[model samples]
Target: MGRYILKRVGYMFLTLLIITTITFFLMHSIPGDPLAHMAKNLPEQVKQNYYKKYGLDEPVFVQYGKFLKNIVTEGNLGESLRYPGRSVTDTVLENSKVSGRIGFQAVSIGIVIGITLGVIAALFRNKWPDYLVMFIAILGITVPTFIIAALFQYLLTVKFEILPTTGWGSFKHTILPTIALAFTPIATYARYMRSNVLEVSNQDYILTAQAKGVSQFNIVIKHILRNAILPAITILGPQIAGIFTGSFVIEKIFGIPGLGSYYITSINDRDYTMIIGTTIFYAAIFVVAQLLTDILYGIVDPRIRVSNKDQ
Candidate 1:
């Protein structure tokens, strides 16, 4: 298990390195100055100084080397081009708190509610409850997150005035955005859980338990959900990215100050450091999430560990 975990961690770092290299080169290939927004007004010497100061005048490989060095030795992500004097790490850490809070709520809501709905749907298969859950899952999967965010803003904030229209401060500010971000995952997990539950229900052990006079509740609690939930855990790895990406527009729509908002703005303004830093940050998140999911997968199913060792 320790060897497997160390291997996964090593792979995670390798993945981050590849993502960073790709993002850096891609940003450079875009054929525009990172300081273009301010270049028009600055004197030629000042513009040149800006370029040299940012190591932009150097070769790409030189810049990449320095960037990697700083990250390894100093844990620095460089300074933001858009926000002068502010480090990219600081910006990311600061705004991530907001995004983190909303993301935590979103994932929690999705897991609990999605699992419950899946169980209910599985229990009531071929009934109206199952149909309704399937309909909701279809709606969530088919509709884009931005549309859901927009409609939520309109109906909940504009039409009914049930929640704040926009801004970030209190718990009320988080509700709409959290739910909007959660919708897709809720749908995804519901389908995954329901399918797993149905499959687990048919297993020989389930029938054996039933024949042994085990109560329905114990059979489900001990056998059905336990096994069914293992598959659902794997979905969390990819869904973390989905929730964060979905939060980009949702944060913008709701006027929340989160990392996603800064990431989008950095792209538009061609802030290379901010863009690269945030991209790396998000990629790290995805890699770490997948690592955790893999660990959890092994813990839940000992066969996975044995298989991994055999590999």
Candidate 2:
């Protein structure tokens, strides 16, 4: 297990390196310059000074080498081109708190409600409950998140004044964005869970348990749930990474300060350091999530643990 984890971490670093390199080159290749906002009326000498300040006066390869060295020696992600003194690392850390809060709420709500709906639907297959779950899942999958956000703002805030339409810093402010973000994930987990439960129900162990006069609740809680939940856990890692980054559109519509807003702004402004930094941060989160998911697979299923140990 230790070896496996180390190997995965090694791969994660290699992946991040590749992503950083690619993002760096591609961002530079774009037509606009990071200094466009300030370069319009500046004299030649001042522009050169700005270039020197950002190390843009050097060759791209030289800049890349120094960037790598800084990362290796000091963990520096460079300063923001647009925001003056702010380092990219600090920016990500500070803004991620808001995004993380919404993501945690969304993920918790998604898993609980989605799993419960799935279980209920599976227990009452072909009944109205099953149909209702299907209908909701379909709607969630079909609707775009932005549209959902807009509709939520209109209905919940505009029509009834049930929740605040926009802003941050309070639980009431989080409600709309959290629910909007959770909608698709809830549908996703429900569909996956419902399928897994139905499949597990047909397994021979489930039949034996049922035939042995086990209580329905016990059969579900112990036998059905454990086996059925594996697939959901498998997809959860990437979903978590994506959700925690938050949706840029959702943030814009709701006026919540989140990492996504910074990320999008960085791209639009061609803030190279911020762009590369946030991308690497996102990739790291995804890689870590994937590693955790693999570890959890072994914990959840002894068969997986055994196979991994043998490998």
Candidate 3:
């Protein structure tokens, strides 16, 4: 198990290196200078000084090398070109709190609601409850999150004045975004889990348990649920990480501070450091999440863990 984890971590670093290299050159290849905002109508000497200050005067390869070194050795992401002296690491960490919190709530809500709906639908297959679950799942999948957000803002806030339409720092404000974000995930898990449970129900063990007169609830909680939920766990791991870095659109529409806003702004301002820093940070999160997911597979299924160990 330890060896497998180390191997996965090694692969994660390799993937991150590739992503960094690709992202770095591609960003530079775009037809704009990071200092363009500073360079507009500026004197030549001042522009040159600015270039020197940010190391833009250095060759691209040299800058890339130093960029890798700073992150790998000094554990630094340097300064934010947009904020001027604010460390990229600090900026992201501070802003990520809101994003992380929202993501946690969203994913939690998604799993609980989705699993419950799915299990109910599966257990009551072809019944009214099944129809209702399927209806909700289909609706969530069809609707875009923003539309959901807008509708929530309007109905809950505009019409009834039950919830705030915008802003953060309060549970009331979190309601709209969390629901909007969680709905799709709810739909996704419901569909997948419903199918998985139906299939698992047909398994021989399930039949044996039912024939042995085990209570329906015990069979479901012990026999059916454990195996049925494995697939959801596998997919949910990376999604948990993804939801954190990817609420950019949601955050913007609702005016929440997060890495997403910084990322979009950095591109527009051509703040190269901030752009690369955030990209790398997000990539790292994604890679680690995947690694953890793989590790979790071993825990969930000892058969899988034993097979990998033998290899």
Candidate 4:
């Protein structure tokens, strides 16, 4: 298990390095200067001086080298163009709180509701409850998140005035956006869990347990749910990463101050430092999530550890 974990961590580091390199070069490759968009009023001589001061006048490779070195040694993501003297790190930290909070609530709500509905639906197959759960799950998958977000904003916020329309304030502000973001995940989890449960419940061991006069509830709790939920656990890593990334749209629609909003603003303003910094933060989260998922697999199922050793 330790060796497997080490291997996974090593792979994650390599992957992150590759992603960082690609992202850095690609962002630089885009036409027009980062300062061009910002310093429209500055004279050409002043603009050139600014470029020289920032080492932007240097060769692309040299600039990349400096950028990489700054990241490694000083942890500097460069200064923001929109807000001079402020570091990109500071901006991300300030804004990320809103997105993080919303993502957390959405994912939490999604996992609980999705898993429960899925289990109940599978357990009561062909019944009214099963049908109702299936219908909701299908709706979640079919509806786009943006549309759901818009409708919730319109109906719950604008029409009824039951919730606030925008900004992060009371819990009331979060209700609509959270539901919209969580709805798709709820649908996805329900379907995945239902399939897994249906498969596990019919396995030979399950049949044997039933034949041995095991209580129905115990069979489900001790055997079915345990095996069935394993696959769902694997999905959690990507799901978490996705929730953070997906907040871009949700934040914009709801006028929340978050990393998503910061990213969009940075891109429009051609704020290179802010863009790269946020991208790195996001990439790191994704890498860490993947590593956690692998470790969780071994912890959840001893069979995985045994299999790894044999391999």
Candidate 5:
């Protein structure tokens, strides 16, 4: 188990390195002068100084080497080209807090809603309750998040005047964006959980549990849900990117101040450091989420053996 964990950690570092390298080269490869997008025009000499200051004047490989070294040693992501004085790390930190909060709420709502609906659908398969759950899940999956966000803003804020249309503050402000951000995942997980639950229902152990006169509630919660939800972890490993993408769209629609909003602006402005920084940040998140999910598999299922011997 320790060796497997160590190996996963090593792979995480390698993945981040590749992501940083690809993002840095890709940013530099774009055909445009970074100085051209600056807030104000500068003299030729001043532009050259800006290029040199950012080490853009150096060979790409040299700059890449320095970039890795600085991040490893000093945790410096360099100053943001757009923000001028703020470091990339600071900018990401400030904005990530907002994104993280939204992502957390969105996922929490999604998991609860999806799992509950899925369980009901599975238990009453072929009945009206099952059809109702499937119908809602289908709508969630097929409808685009942007459309949902727009409709939510118009109906909830403009029509009903119950929720705010823009800005981030207070619980009321989060209601619409959170719903918009959660729809896709709720659909995806509902399908996944329902399918897994049906499959688990057919296993011999379930029959044995039933034969033993186990209460239906205990069987569903203690046995069915615990086992059925295990497969959902597989989905979560890749869902981090989905959550970020949803947050991006939802944030833009509602004017929330998250890293996703800033990350998009950084791309439009061609802020190389900010682009690379956010890309690396996302890569790190993907790697860590997958690792944690792997660890959780063992805890959730005793059948998942983790021997010390290397695979």
Candidate 6:
């Protein structure tokens, strides 16, 4: 397990290196200079001086080397062109708090509600409850999150005056956004869990348990749910990570001050430092999530341990 973890971490570092290199060159290759976007009113001579001061006048490779060196030694993400002396790392960290909070809430709600509904639906297959849950799941997958958010904003906020339309403040402000983000994941989880449960419940072991006159509830909980939930756990890593990154659109629409909103603004303003900083942050989160998922697989199945030993 320790060796596996070390190997995974090594791969994560290599992935980050590749991402950083690509982001560096791509940002540099864009048509307009970051300085030009920021200092539009400045005279050409002044702008050239600014470029030279920032080493933007240097060869791309030289600039990339300096960028990499700054990251390695100073732990700096460089200064933001949009905010002059401000460090991009600081900006992203500040905003990431909000995004992280929303993502946590949404994913928690998704997993809990989704898994419950799925389990229930599987247990009571073809019943009214199952049909109702399936219908809702279908809607979740079909509707875009933004559309649901917008509709809720208009109906719940605009007409009913029941919820806040935008901005982050109290719990009320978070409810609509969280629901919008969670609905799709809930749907996905429900469907996946339902299928897995149905399949696992029908296996020979379940029949043997039944033949042994094991209590129905215990069989469902101890046998069916444990074995069935493995796939859902595997999907959780990417799903949670995706929610954080994909929140960019939702954050913008809702006027929430989050990493997603910051990323969008940084891209629009061509803030190279912030862009790369956020990208690296996102990549790191994805790597960690994937690692966690692998660990979870071992926890869910003792067979995995036996297989590892055999190998």
Q: State every prediction's TM-score relative to the real structure.
A: 0.96, 0.96, 0.96, 0.94, 0.95, 0.94
Q: How does each model score on lDDT?
A: 0.91, 0.89, 0.87, 0.88, 0.86, 0.88
Q: How much is the lDDT of residue 105 in candidate 5? A: 83
Query: lDDT per residue, candidate 2, 112-164, as tens digits?
Result: 99998988889899999999999999988999889889998999999999988
Q: Candidate 2 — which residues are off by over 4 angstroms?
A: none
Model 2 alpha-carbon miss at residue 127, Å:
0.4
Q: What is the lDDT of residue 120 in candidate 6?
A: 94
lDDT string, candidate 3, 1-311, tens digits? 88888998899999999999998888878887778876778999988988898888888899889889998998788898777889998888888788878888999999899999999999999999999999999989898778888888889989999987778878877878888889878988998889999999999999999999999999999988889988988777667876876588899888887778888898888887888888888888888888888888889888888888797
* CA error at residue 135 for candidate 5, angstroms: 0.8
Can you tell me which runs of candidate 3 are displaced by over 4 Å? none
lDDT of 5: 0.86
Q: Which residue segments of model 6 deviate by more than 4 Å?
A: 43-45, 309-311
lDDT of 1 by residue, 75-192 (tens): 8999988778899998999999999899989998999989988988998899999999999999889998889989999999999999999998899999999989889888988898
Residues 182-254, candidate 4: write the lDDT tens digits.
9988998999999999999889999999999999999989999889989998889888889899888888889
Candidate 1: lDDT over CA atoms?
0.91
Comparing 1 with 4 on TM-score, the higher-scoring candidate is 1
Instruction: Count clashes in each candidate, considering only residues at least 3 apart in sequence or on different chains.
Output: 0, 0, 0, 0, 0, 0
> Candidate 1, TM-score vs. the true structure?
0.96
lDDT of 2: 0.89
- RMSD of every candidate to native, in Å, equals 1.4, 1.4, 1.3, 1.6, 1.6, 1.7
Worst 10 residues of 6 by lDDT: 302-311
**In candidate 3, how many Å is residue 28 off?**
1.1
